[model samples]
Target chain A: MSYLTLSITLIFVIIPLILSKTFKLGLERDTIIAAVRSIIQLLAVGYVLQFVFNAENAVYIVLMLLLMIGAATQNARKKGASIKGITWKLIVTFLFIEILTQSILLGLDITPPTAQYVIPISGMVIGNSMVLGILFLNRFTAEMETRQNQTELILSLGGTPKQAVHTQLITSIKASTIPTIESQKTIGLVQLPGMMSGQIIAGADPVQAVLFQLLILFLLLTTAVTTSIMLGYLSYPTLFNQRMQFLRESLIRE
Target chain B: MTKAAIEFKDVDYTANGIHILKRITGFFPKGKITTLVGPSGAGKSSLFKLCNGLQTANSGQIYINNKLIEQYAPTVLRRTVGIALQEATMINGSVEKNLALPLTLKGEKLHKELAIELLKVVGLKESYMSRNTQELSGGQRQKLSIARTLVNKPQVLLLDEITSYLTVYPSRTSKN
Candidate 1:
C-alpha cells in the first residue's frame, strides 16, 4: 500500500473523533492520542522490523524477543506489584510461554527459523501472556478479599497455606482462561481474527492464512492456560509466611 | 480451676493508627465457657483473632497450652483452637461440605454419618446435610459455621457473638 492509502486511514480516525465529540463521550482526546500513538509506534516498529529482517542476525532476533518480554513484564507487573518478586514472576511466565511456543513451532519444522517468524510470534505469545497475567492477578486478589473469612476459617482449622488459598487460585486461573477458550470457540464464526485477516489483506492465500491462524489458535490456548496456572502457583505461595499465616498484605491493592 | 487454653500478656494491637487492643492481659481457660461482654468497637473479635494466630498482637506475646503461640506451627495452632466469627461466611456448597471442610483440609473424607451427626449437634436436622448453604437463613448459616469449627474437635473454641444467632454450643461444654 502507498502512503496515499495510509493517509486515507486518517478518515477512520476522524470518524471516531467526530462521533466522540457529537456524543460528548469525552473520549475525543483519548481517541486522538490512541490514533497518534498507534501510527508512530507501528511506523517505528515497521522500520525496526525491516532493519532486523535484513540484518538476519540471530543476536538481533534474540534482542527483539527480549525487548518484547521486558515490555510485557513491566506492564504486567503493575497489576501484581503487591505480589512478591512479581516482576521476575511475570518475566518467567512470559519467557516460558515464548520458549514453549517457539520450540514447538521450530522443533516440528512448522515454521522456518527466520527472524520474521520468530519475532512476530514471540510478540503475540508474550503479549497474550502479559494480558493473562494481569487478568489472573486481578481476579485472584479480588477472590482473596471477598473470601477472606473463608480463608481464615480454613487456616484456623489446621489447613495449610496452600489449602487456604486453593479456591482463589483455581477460581482465578479458570476465570482468566475462560475468555481465551471461549473466544477461540467462536473464532471463524464470530470474527476473522486480526492476524488471519491481516495476512489475507496482505495478499496471502486464504488457505495459508487460515492454516497460520489455526497454528496461532492452538499456541494461544496453551499460552492462556499455562500463563494463568503458572502465575497462580508462583503467586499463591507468596501470600503466606513461614508460619503459614496469610500475609494480608497481599490483598492490599497496589 | 480449669487450665487456660489461651493466654495473652501485655498485648497491644493497633489498626490504621487506632489502638484497638492495648496491653490486654487475660486467659480463656480450657473446659469452660468464657463470655467476653462488650459493646461494638470493643476488641472482642480482635482478641479472638489473636488467639487463633490469624493476627498477631502488635506488642505482646500469646500462649496456647502454655507454649508461645508463635512457636507453634500455624496449622497446628489453628487446628488446636477453632474460632467462629460473628459474620458467617460459607463456601459455595452443600451444608455437608462446609461442615466437612476441616476434615477435607486434613485430606480425610468426612463420613456421611458424622456429617449428619455434626449437623444435628448444631441443632440442624440430618436432612440439612444435603441442603445448599446458599439456601440457608442467617441463623442456619451461623449454625453451620459453628458446626464446621467442631469438625476437628478443636481443643479450644473461641466463639464471637455466637449466642446472638442461636442458643447452641452445648457441645463445647459437652466435649469436656
Candidate 2:
C-alpha cells in the first residue's frame, strides 16, 4: 500500500481517540471497544473471503449475504423491541435491493462475480440496509408507542389511519433520508466518501470515480427511501387490530 | 334532544384476556367537566380511552357528538376528543411548537398567538411562549399539556391523573 493510504488509515484510527479526549465526548470506552471489535471482525472476514473468493461460488456469496441480512434483522428487532416479525420484512427488502443492484452491475458488465466487485458492492448494500433498518424501525416503534392514541383519535374523527399518520410517515422518511441527503450535499466539498476515494486509490481516473460515486449516491437514495416507506407501511398492521384499536399487547415490549 | 357529548353502552374491554373495563355505560355531557373517580385500576383510564376512540369496546358501541364514534376518522376523532395523560410529554421543540402541533397535524398554519393565549389560560406566563418545554417546571409542563389539548378546541378533553403531578396549590388554582 502507498504511504498515502497508510497515512489515511492511521488518521481514521487516531481521530476517535483525539475526539474523545478533546471534547470529553464521554464515549471513550465505547469508541475504543468498537474500534477493537471492528478490527478483529474485519480481519476475520478477510481471512474467510480468501476461501470464498477462490471458490467464486454464488451460493457461498448468497449465503454470506443472507447471514448478514439475518444479523441486521436481529439488530433491528432488539432495537425496536415491540416490532414482531420484522425479521422477514427486513430480509425481503434486503433481498429486493441486493438483487436489483447486482443485476444492474452485472448487466452493465461493470464488475463480475469476483470478490473485488461483489464483496464491496454487497458491503455497501448491506451497510445502507442496516442503517435504513435502524432508522425505519426506530421511527415506527417510537411513533407507534407515543402517538397510538392520536392515531386512533384521528380515525374516530373520520380520518383513515393512512391519513392520520401521513405527517408522521413523512417525518419518518425524512428522518431516515436526511443523513444520506447531507452526505450527498457535502460529498467532494466537505469530505471524501469511501467508495469514490477507494476508486481513486485503486488508480481509477478521477472522472470515473466521480461517476461511480454518483451511482452509489443514487442507489443509496433509492434503497433508503424504499426501505423506509416499506417498513413503515408493513409495521402498521402489526400495531392495530381488525376493529382499528391499537393493540395493547403489540405495543408492550416483552 | 341533542345527543350527549359521549355515550358508552355496555362496553366490555379486555386486554390480554384481563378485563380492564367491564360493562361500562355512561353519558358525559358537553360543556362540563365530568370527573371519573374510582380506586386504582377501576377502569377509569380505560373508560376514558374508549370514549376517545383510543380503545374499542369488546361488545358495545360509543357515540360522540351524536354520531357513532367508530364512523368518524381517526384524525377527526382525535381532534375532537383531546386527551392528556399523566405522563404527558412535551415534544422536542419550543413551547409554541408543542401547543400548535395539533393544529399543524390537521394541516393548519402556525398560530403563534394561540399557544401564548392558551398558556395564559392554563396560568402560564406569556413569556413562556418562546421557552423550551423541557426547561419548564412540573406544573408549567402540565399547564402546557392542557394548553396543547385546547389547540384543536376539542369538544371533550380526557384527563388522567393530570392534577396528580402538580404541586399543592396549582392543582387547586387550575381546577378553579
Candidate 3:
C-alpha cells in the first residue's frame, strides 16, 4: 500500500475521536494518543525489521528476538509484580516459549530458517505467550488471595507447597488457556486471524495461507498451556518462604 | 508436669507494620485441654498458625513436643500439629474425600472405620461421609473440618474457635 492509502487509515482514528467527543466519553485524548503511538511504533518497527531482514545475519535475528522477549517480559510482569522475582520468571517463561516454538518450527522444517519467516512467527508466539502469562498470574494471584484460608489449612495439614497451590494452579492454567481454546474453536466462523489475512493480502494462495494459519493456531495452543503451567509453578514458590510459611505480606495490596 | 504439647517463647508476629503478637510466651501442656480466652483480634488464630508451620514467628521460637518447631520438616511438623480454622474451608468433594486428604498426603490407606468414628466424635453421622460437603450446613462443615483434622491423628490439635460454628459441642470432640 502507498503512503497516501496508509494515511487514509487516520480517518478511522478521526472517526473514533469525533465519536468520543460528541458522546462526552472523555476518551478523545486517549484515543488520539493511542492511534498516534501505534502509527509511530509500527512504522519504526517496519523500518527496523526491513534492515534486519536485509542483513539476514544470525546475530541480528537473535538480537531482535531478545528485544521482543525483553519487552514482552516487562509488560507481562506488571500483572505479577506482587510475587518476588516475578520479572526473571517472566523472562525465562517467555524465552522458553520463543525458543521452544522457533526451534520446533526450524528443526522440523515446518517453516524455513529465514528472518522473513522467523521474525513474524516469533513475534506472534512471544506476544501471545506474554498475554497468556499475564492472564495466568493475575488469576493465580487472585485465587491465592481469595483462598488464603484454604491454602493455609492445607499447609497446616501437612501438605507441601505443591499440594497447597495445586488447585489454584490448575484453575489458573485452565482459565488462561480458555481464550486461546475458544478463539481457535471459532477461528473460521468468527474471524480471520491476522496471519492468514496478511498472507492472502500478499497474494499467497488461500489454501496455503489457511494451512499456515492452522500451524500457528496449533503452536499457540501449545505455547499457551506450557507458559501458563510453567509460570504458575515458578510464581507459587515465591509466595512462600524457605521456612514453608506463607508470606502474608506478599498478598497485601501495594 | 507433663511436657508442653506446644510452647511459644518470646514469640513476635507482625503484619503490615502492625504488631499482632509481641513478646508472647506460653505453653499448652500435653494430655490436657487448654483454652485461650480473649476478645476478637487477640491473635488466637495467629498463635495456632505459629504452632504448626503455616506462619513463622517474626522473632523468637515455637516448639512442638519440646522440639524447635523450625527443626521439624514442615510436612512432619504439620502432621504432628494440625489446625482447624474457624471457617472450615471444605475441599470440593464429598466429606469422605476431605477426611481422606490427610491420609492421602501421607500415602496411607484411608481407614473407613476410623473416618466414620471420627465423624461420630465430632457429632456427625456415618451417612454424612458420602455427602457432598458443599451441601452441608455451616455447623456440619465445622464438624467435618474437625473430623478431617482428626483423621491425621495429630498429637497436638489446634482448634481456632472452631466450636463457634457448632450448635452444640459434643463431649467426645476433645477426647483426643
Candidate 4:
C-alpha cells in the first residue's frame, strides 16, 4: 500500500475520535494517543523487522526474540506484579513458548528456518502467552481475594498451602482459558481470523492461508493452557511461606 | 491445673494502623470447653486465627500443645486445632466430599461410615451426605463445616459463632 492509502486508514481512527467527541465519552485523548502510539510502534517494528530479515544473522534473530520477550514480559508483568519474581516468570514463560513453538516448527520443517517465518510466529506465540498470563493472573488474584476465607478454612483444617489454593488456582486457570477455547470452537464459522484474511488478501492461496492459520490456532491453544498452568504452579508456591502459611501480605494488591 | 491445648503470650496484631489485638495473653485448656465471647471486631476471631497459625502475630508467641506455634508445621498445627467460622465456606461438592476434605488432603481413605457418623454427630442426616452443599441451608452448611473439621479429629476445636445459623445447637460437641 502507498503512503497515501495508509494515511487514508487514519479515517478509521477519525471515525472513532469523532464518535467519542459526539458522545462525550472522554476518550478523545486516549483514542488519539493510542492511534499515534500504534502507528509509531508498528512502523518502527516494520523497519526493524525489515533490517533483521535482510541481515539474516542468527544473532539478530536472537536479539529480536529477546526484544519480543522483554516487551511481552513488561506488558504482562503489571497484572501479576504482586507475584514474587513475576517479571522473570513472564520472561521465562514467553521465552519458553517461543522456543517450544519454534523448536517444533523448525525441527519438523513445518516452517522454514528463516527470520520471516520465526519472527512473526514468535510474535504470535509470545504475544498469546503474555495475554494468557495477564488473564490468568488477573483471574487468579481475584480468586485469591474472593476465596480468601475458603482458602483459610482449608488451611485451618490441616490442609497444605497447595491444597488450600488448589480450587482457586484451578478455577483461575480454567476461567482464563475459556475465552481462547471458546473462540477456537467457532474460529472460521463465526469470524474470519485476521491472520488468515491478511494472508489471503496478500494473494496467498486460500488453502495455504487456512493451513497456516490452523497452525497458529493450535499454537495459541497450547499457549493458552500451558501459560496458565505454568504461571499457576510458579505463582502459588510463592503466595505462601516455608511454614505453609498463606502469605496474605504478598497477595495484597498494590 | 488442666493442660493448655493452645496458649498465647503477649500477642499483638495491628491492621491498617489500628490495634486489633495488643499484648493479648491467654490459654484454652485441653479436654475442656472454651467460649470466646466478644462483640463484633473484638479480635476474637483474630485470636483463633493466631492459634491455628492462620495469621502471624506482629509481636507475640503462640503455642500448640506446649510447643511454639512457629515450631509446628502450619498444617500439623491446624489439623490439631480445627476451627469452624460463622460463615461456613463449603467446597463445591457433595456433603460427603466436604466432610472428607482433610482426609483427601492426607491421602487417607474416607470410610462411608465415618462420614455418616460425623454428619450424625453434627446433627445432620445420612441423606444430607449426598446433598449438594449449595442446596444446604445456613445451619446445615455450618454443621457440614464442623463435621469436616471433626473428620480430622483435632484435639482442640475453635468454634467461631458456630451456632449462629443452627436451629438447634449440636450440644453433643460440648458434651464430648
lDDT of 4 by residue, A1-254 (tens): 98899999999999989999999999999999999999999999999999999998989999999998998888888755478889887877787778788899999999999999999998898888988999999999889988888887788888888889999988999998999999999989979999999999999999999999999999999999999998888889988888777777787777
lDDT of 3: 0.87
- How well does candidate 1 reproduce the true complex, by DockQ? 0.74
For model 2, how does the per-residue alpha-carbon lDDT over B1-176 read when each residue is reduced to its tens digit?
55589987888999777888878787888877788888988888778777767777789888898788788775677778877755666666888877777666566766667666677778888887889988898777778777777777788888777877577646544553
Error of 3 at B176 (Å): 5.2
Show the lowest summed lDDT stretch of 10 residues, model 2 chain A. A152-161
Candidate 4 residue lDDT tens string, B9-114: 8989987678999898888888888788889999988888888778888998888888888888778888888888767998888888888888989999799988
- TM-score, prediction 3: 0.95
- How do all the candidates rank in terms of DockQ, highest first? 3, 1, 4, 2
Q: Worst 10-residue stretch by lDDT in candidate 2 chain B?
A: B167-176
Candidate 1 CAPRI-style tier: medium
DockQ of 3: 0.81
Who is ahead in TM-score, 1 or 3? Answer: 3
Show model 3 residue runs off by greater than 4 Å. B172-176
Candidate 1: where are CA atoms >4 Å away? A79-82, B167-176
Q: How far does residue A203 in candidate 3 sit from its true spot (Å)?
A: 1.1
> How would the docking of model 2 be graded?
incorrect
lDDT tens readout by residue for model 3, A1-254: 99999888889888988888899999988987898899899999999999999998989999999999999988887755467888888888988888899889999989999999889999999999999988888899899998888788788788888888899999999999999999888898988989899999999999999999999999899899999998988889988888777876787655
Model 4 lDDT at residue B86? 68
